[model samples]
Target: MPRFFKQPFFAWFSPSPSRLQRRQLRQAIAHIIGDQPSNLDVYQLAVRHTSAAKETKIKGFRESNERLEYLGDAVLGMVIAEYLFKKYPFKDEGFLTEIRSRIVNRESLNGISRKIGLDHLIEYDGQRGRLMPARTSMYGDALEALVGAVYLDKGFNFTRRFILKNLLSHYDLDSIISNNTNFKSRLIEWAQREGKELRFEIISENGSSQYREFIAQLLVNDEPFATGSGYSKKKAEQSAAEKAFEKLELQ
Candidate 1:
């Protein structure tokens, strides 16, 4: 079956431009991509999306990022899975899977995208009410698309090396494994040691379409110790824990 057939209905509604008309776009992309892609079509399709592209004159003439995102997602998962499996040969499948999940998850991908400055390179039209300026989801998607681009531009070897160097290398495997840590667990340990009741209750969790904000309160022995907010519940809890730890001088 054709890939287009597999795409959602909204995809076909947005018209993608002809190859000739996309020459200028390809040039713009070349500037951003830094190297001429071996396959410009893939790169162009990655940037096009129903939400981002719009047409005033023609009834339909736009691009969509959905397909690229889909392809990128598969590529990323495969590469990460292989890397983890090979790197941690002694570890069981479950251990390797967890680490891979953590490494390629939304938060981690967003962080890597920011570090490599992919956020700035993204191009989108202003037709949508307001693009999420949060930089996490967009950048994360872009990171995946970038992996797809790299795979097409160079090959699996190049893409694999890039992922390892840029994203995976930053992670301290030793520290991560030894710590096996997260804020909620750490807080629990502290509370147990201090003989205090640690509690995290959701306060206000709301946000616009671009982002979701979570507010959480930390209580120690029924006493509110700290308040924290973040894009995710876990992150919010972590922030609250840090604040509580600081207040208790347990840092």
Candidate 2:
């Protein structure tokens, strides 16, 4: 069992964790992550979704997992890159990058987070009165936040061990490497081989500046082939290219 407020910095927060909440949270963290968390508040914050974030006095903006997610994104990428480097000492940069992308992509992380039961631990605002489906990225985002929490609580080496020994160990690396998809590259290659001109043009943009959505259309031989939408121009192009690839079924 991990002791709460064990650090001097945590003591400054003036936390008062109920016995039951502390026990339950500690046990849950231990079970899910296979380690004790030094800072309970950080873990709690990590599991808190933006929808459920509350306004804080320090700043007008509410506290959410977004910052932690950003930190974890960088941390996760670095650790995974290191792991892949060591795992395949002779592999080329492109190969390593492809494998890392396959491992860290939104779809893969969402699936992995669900597999590790992070979905059940997330705290979100379900009472917002929306009948639509839940976003798949939420689980993945929480997973990243959790990684941030782990990093904060236990430092880099511990987080690395947790990721490598606990999380990455569960994945089938060989299969991931084999099934790596670079749809944009594939589309470009297909266009070159078929002697067709390929162009990806942004059709529209929406959402706030911080979180923008882009719609891209794939034009083959100056004719529209397929359209796709994503959070960025590159993502949209890749998505459009994926659709085009599927439609063309290039061998």
Candidate 3:
């Protein structure tokens, strides 16, 4: 548990941060999200990773960013879908969906998080590293959680603007569309051509009942090659394949 949860007096409640610390965090978040928030708790919760999380005594829920991540995923996807629909007026649904997927994927969001310095602000158990494994989407998950906080704090219009101006502005849609490659399909082709035994299997599933997590591991020559996770098997497979694609250097 983090020191913030350790109050000499009321151990059940989180202690208030120092005035200077509060100001610094508020400024940092304002720089990222483009607004000074009225409610700091929501944004603070956005960056708290599960490894450092504390469960509520009554609710039986940890004070982590998972719920916010879920909400933000939907909000971010919808905004991206709407933007693509308008920008590519004559594009087919397939094209729109593919482009949107490329933009909103975990790796893509993680890269953006690094670019925008959001990775620096996330609070997790760094020593034990309980939340980080290879190719973990912690950075992007924090970003999604931040988006959820923005939505809750400032409402949809502000959140949409923040997504467009702060997030999407960092992307080049035309370049992304042209350079897009589906790792799972490419990996499948590589295996077929090289006569290498390749497969993907779901190793685990755990999350809220509304959105179950699927962890998929890629196997090559009957050995585990790489693993990835998502809300669905197909996405988990895709994520695992992406990691495998990088390691295998498949074209």
* lDDT, candidate 1, 131-183, per-residue tens: 54453266678778877776777787767777777667667767656644466
The candidate scoring highest on TM-score is 3
Per-residue lDDT for 1-251 in model 3, tens only? 22233322112123445676567678978888877888988888888777768678868777889999999999999999999999999999999998998899887888788777776667766565655432578888989999999999999999999999999999988799888477898898889999999989999999889989999999999999999998999999999998997676443
Measured by TM-score, how close is model 2 to the native structure? 0.69
Query: How many backbone overlaps does candidate 3 show?
Result: 0
State the lDDT of candidate 2 residue by residue for 1-251, as single tens digits: 11221332122212344677667667878887887778888888877777667688978889878889998888899999999999899999989998997788776777777777666666666565351213447878988998999999999999999899877887898888777377998878877888999989999999999999999999888999999999999999989988886576442
**Candidate 2 vs candidate 3, TM-score winner:** 3
For model 3, give the 10-residue run with minimal summed lDDT. Answer: 4-13
TM-scores of the models, in the order given: 0.55, 0.69, 0.71
For each candidate, the alpha-carbon lDDT, in order, equals: 0.67, 0.78, 0.82
Backbone atom clashes (below 3 Å) for every candidate: 7, 0, 0
Better of 1 and 2 by TM-score: 2
C-alpha RMSD in Å of predicted model 1 compared with the true structure: 12.5
lDDT of 3 at 183: 85
Strongest candidate by lDDT: 3
Sort all candidates by lDDT, best to worst: 3, 2, 1
